[model samples]
Target: MKYIKIRIPKATVYFTPVEIEKLLNKNIEITNKLLTQQTEIFKEGLKRGKCFIRSSKQKIREERKI
Candidate 1:
């Protein structure tokens, strides 16, 4: 009598549930830090005589070709 051997392939995942959660938390922390730094810079710019001025709109007689 001859017996046949079969092999099954196993599926591999790169990120498990715990790992994904850690990654997401780290990304959120980094983003919050960056936002805080940017806000500080914007506040300083506002105090240093930086202003947003609207440019005068000009009437265009020529039509733009799309």
Candidate 2:
């Protein structure tokens, strides 16, 4: 048997803010800080993926030239 590992990049999702103050009082609502941190995480992961793709393309080009 062979195993393959793959990583899929996730795009940022748009979530509607509930206007009710009662919903805001619950722990289930995401805090602004947490949302900011999650956004940064997504940005970083996508950035890394983009760099990896560029590097791989460069390597392939170099190999073809040789």
Global lDDT of each model? Answer: 0.64, 0.72
Model 1 lDDT tens row, 1-66: 333333447744455566767878999999999999999998988766433322111122222321
Residue lDDT tens for model 2, 1-66: 333333457644333344333556664456877888999999999999999999999999999999
Q: TM-score, each model?
A: 0.55, 0.55
Q: Which candidate is the best by lDDT?
A: 2
TM-score of 1: 0.55
| Candidate 1 Cα misplacement greater than 4 A, ranges | 1-13, 50-66
